[model samples]
Target: MSNHELGTVQVYTGNGKGKTTASLGLALRALGHNFRVCVIQFMKGSSEYGEYKALEKFENATVHLMGRDTFVNKEAPEVEDVELAQEGYEKARESMISGKYDIVILDEVNVALDFHLIEVEQVLELMDIKPKNVELVLTGRNADKEVVKRADLVSEIKEVKHHFQKGIPSRKGVEH
Candidate 1:
């Protein structure tokens, strides 16, 4: 396959702060390769996150969030949450088919599934339907075992150290 035809789906998980960060790194890498990247921020609406703030300015990437753009309650996800998640999924699916983006990162997509905001089956279907040359990446904790099974690469970031434990709050340009 030509370099343009290289396509694979990656899953980044585990209890770590860098799941999304790693995905963003990949997105930047792809963009540097002259590949168009699309990032769908499921369950995230605010653009205050450092990556969002930086990536949103990139010419080759577009970021969109489906939910109300607030922190979620893992203990109490409502049906409306699922609906918004579906909307985000649809946007991802649409981007997958639009054939414009070379790489698509469904950031926090698995979290939506774990939270029952999106169906795992639907994600699988979308993955199956993607173009052969379109690369895909999914980021979030608790990514389904099925998803990990289907992915070409699955990396879990186990947290061994975090400054947050020492009471350093998240900051702009570093941990927004």
Candidate 2:
């Protein structure tokens, strides 16, 4: 597995928006270069991301979405949502091991781990077990430092100012 030139694993973390967007951008760029891309979106069930929709038109990209439409919170956590996220990660791990994709985005995986539905140790183990050529990405706020340390690039999107805090609800195409 170490024989091939390894790709990078990145962390897109912080309180601001666009964590998944950043990863999607990477996927898009990879796809442009004829790289096969796979995205496993956690915390998102039937809803669609515009990037996913666009990528679906291409023959090279595939998206596996798992989750219900619900927000995560400390007070009233979505137990089922987190469970589904864990299941998605299990499938994601399988895909990573299979070496079918040039790049794989485990979108919102960090959030699932933070909620205690997914084990951080298990993810770390999976990282070690991944195919070297498959560039992996884990996105969401509050990414573990251990995970970040293991990443080749770590970008934290600090929320200096956001329209959401200004009472702006999430809009289609923009937020989706």
Candidate 3:
């Protein structure tokens, strides 16, 4: 078994970018230390992301992509979107309790919760039941207040300015 210390719930949320990036950075750090890591991405199905390709190279890391490549409609999400989010949640819960992973990153899970693809109560319960040794990281915008309250560390990445404001489209390897 890994010798990592007890893990705490960390929430990275805001209207700005870098929530996923921050969690992935943590994943990379954990992997560098030879810790088992599981990343279950909610509302993100495309394998084209650069992080997916990079993380795949690590034998100790498992990345599960959940959702379609298309954007989810926040006002009226498709039934399939909901299904995928639920599946992702189940996978995350299992990963946390299985004792196989030292770090579990639920990518875009906050967005999933905000869009009503998954219930806040469910996420709260998952936090409660998380194994003491497994670090749980939740990322995305519009994080619920309750989640923020319960998290051991909350980082709000506010966007003071972004390239998108300058009419610059998402650049390859930078935004993606």
For each candidate in turn, the TM-score is: 0.93, 0.90, 0.98
lDDT of 2 by residue, 1-176 (tens): 22336777888999998898899989888887888888998777764667777888988888988788666674566778767877887888888877678888999888887877688897797678877788989999989889988888999999889997789998878987
- Count the clashes in each prediction: 1, 0, 0
- Expressed as tens digits, the lDDT of each residue in 1-176 for candidate 1 is 12687689999999988988898998888878878889998988787777877887788889887777667787898677778899999999999889889888998899998988878898898789989899889999999999999999999999899999999988778876
Distance from true location, Cα of 91 in model 1, Å: 0.3
Question: Which residue pairs in candidate 2 collide?
Answer: none
Rank candidates, TM-score, best first. 3, 1, 2
* TM-score of structure candidate 2: 0.90
| Model 2 poorest 10 in a row by lDDT | 1-10
Q: Judged by TM-score, which candidate is best?
A: 3
User: Which prediction has the highest lDDT against the true structure?
Assistant: 3
